[model samples]
Target: MTTIVLGAGAVGTATAWYLRKSGHDVVLIERQPEAAMETSWGNGGIIHASEVEPWSQPGMPTKIIKWLGKENAPLLLRYRAIPHIMRWGIEFARNCTPERFRENAKSNLHLALHSLKSLQEIGAEAGIDYDRATRGVLKIYRSRDSLDSAQRSTDYLAQHGLLYERADPDRCVELEPALKDTKSTLAGALYFARDEVGDSNKFAQGLAAACAARGVQCRFGETIEKIETRSGRVQAVVTSKGRIVADTVVVALGSFTAPMLAKNGIRVPIYPVKGVSITFKRAAWNAAPTMPLIDDSKLFGFVPIGDRIRISGSAEITGYDMTPAPARVAAIIANASFTFPELKRYFDISKSKVWAGLRPVSPTGTPIIGETRIRGLWINAGHGHLGWTLSCGSGRVIADLIDGRDPGIPVPPPQGVVVARAA
Candidate 1:
């Protein structure tokens, strides 16, 4: 069967790779000249399966209310004229129940772990390098209250077969000495030794190259104007270049997918949650920490990618503004300096480049995957903050469904009628 995967980010590229491996002729389409040029570009880089919890869990409503319009809040919701954002936000609150949180976390963990295995397999098979490191990820806390909250989350994870070790302030320093500067303010931490980190853009581009090598046609720089259908199934995709026919099509267009699908009468309920990242040249390699670490108090994570250091965090709920906000950029730099003061000189604040990307977030915090109401149309999107971590597994699942084979993971029942492009 011939298939076209939309969006050339990690998810779309991985989907094309797996589809080709599954004996299908695949073509990938992306608007950017390069793959992973958007959300996959400058992520925190932590592939943490154990940390698969929804952002909308119980206490989130109060927090969201408090943080609305706050420049440095962990989650910011900025809005204007869109009803989808409000709709998604309301449903997000609905899913904050304890029951939904546990269920969603379990499902997310399964996908995350499976994706890590798939990622390693792809790395070995394609011999594609993304500056990956298995040095583990640590979530550091500065307040006792924050540490206690982490303990609860960790206990929940432990109940579901994920193990995380509790680390004292000294142990945290031992694990990541670069954090010694913040040791005095740290209350405690949690270490997930199985977790890893890497460059999302490098991974996507590498996989795209591997796909090309495997005879998968990648149509980069192609703007998809619309998706056309016949007899209630996808017939062809209309693009600026031309109309491309396909037996099946998977929409993985990230933030843009929602509106595009909505135009076709499909309400995906995926909203764009903007995030920022700052990548700097490692001026002090010896002093820098090898392990990826998250400062929970500051809501940011520092990921070491070869000679460069990526400090990324801050979820801004502004709709579709990809431009970097100076305030947010400054916050990331200031937060990094607080944690690793030894490398303060290495971090040239003036030279720090700011990048912002939108995360396609769904209400349930789990991606919408499976055959939609539209016969030949499928969806494998809305992985949100975990897109890079869950991409490979999602691709495998979508490929399985396309092949009429049972997805190894339990198929989530269609939550509701998945509307298609209106006539």
Candidate 2:
């Protein structure tokens, strides 16, 4: 059976690998010249299971309201995007209750752990080296109250196989000596020992090469014009080059999935939430911390990937715009310095590379993975900011479902997409 995997980002590339491994003829398509060139390109690179809590957690509505129009806010909602995100925002609000937040966290953690295992397998099989750091991530909190609140979430996730330890101010510095030159005194921290970091773009590119070497057809630099169907079944995908008949079509187009599928009258709850990142060369910064740092108070992360450092964070409810906001980038730099002030003395901030990409977020915080209402049409998208963290697992699950096997873990039911009226 020939299966068409759309969009060769991290998730789509992984799906093609698993599908080919399952003995299916797989063709992976991407508009870019290579895989992971978009959202997967410049992420903070932390495959953190500790950060499973959704953005719609308790009291988040008030926070979003207060953050409205603030350029430097952790989560900003541009006034122009309000009209486009109104319906999605309502569903996001609906998932903000305490009970729902915990349940969503549980679901996210399950997929995240499974993804890590799958990623290890991929790394070994593909022989790809992606500057991996195994020291784990340290999340620091400035206030005792915030630390206590985070502890509750971490403690609950611990029951579901998350390994973590509560760290005092001294332990926080002990975990990462680079934190000793802090600008302000830290209240406490939480360290997730199982979390790891790596360059996702490198991994994706290597995996794509592996897939092609294994005889999976990889057609990059091709624009998908439409999905052709007959008798309510996925018949083929019409691309700019030509139509390729397919037995199954998996939509893994990240933030573009909703619009692409909506063209065929299939509506998904996925919304495009923009995020910003800045990468810097670690020139002359010999003492850069090996372990990733997540500042919970400031809502930013400083991750050292190889000889370069990546500072990334922010959830902007903006529609489809991929332009990086300089103000937001500067805000992230300032926030990152709060935990690692030595960056100013050691690294050149003027040479930082700024980037922005859209994260395809679901209201439930769980990726929508399964066969949709359309026969032979599947979905493996809406991984949100966890695209790299959840990529391989989501791909493996899609392959298992297509191959008539259990997905190893319970998956959300099919036909869960919200059908939208045609404009």
TM-score leader: 2
Reference-based lDDT, each prediction? 0.84, 0.87
Error of 1 at 199 (Å): 0.9
Candidate 1, TM-score vs. the true structure? 0.95
TM-score of every model?
0.95, 0.97
Candidates in order: C-alpha RMSD to true structure? 2.8, 3.1
Error of 1 at 59 (Å): 1.4
lDDT of 2 by residue, 63-99 (tens): 9899998998888998988898787888889899999
TM-score of predicted model 2? 0.97
lDDT of 1: 0.84
Worst 10 residues of 1 by lDDT: 414-423
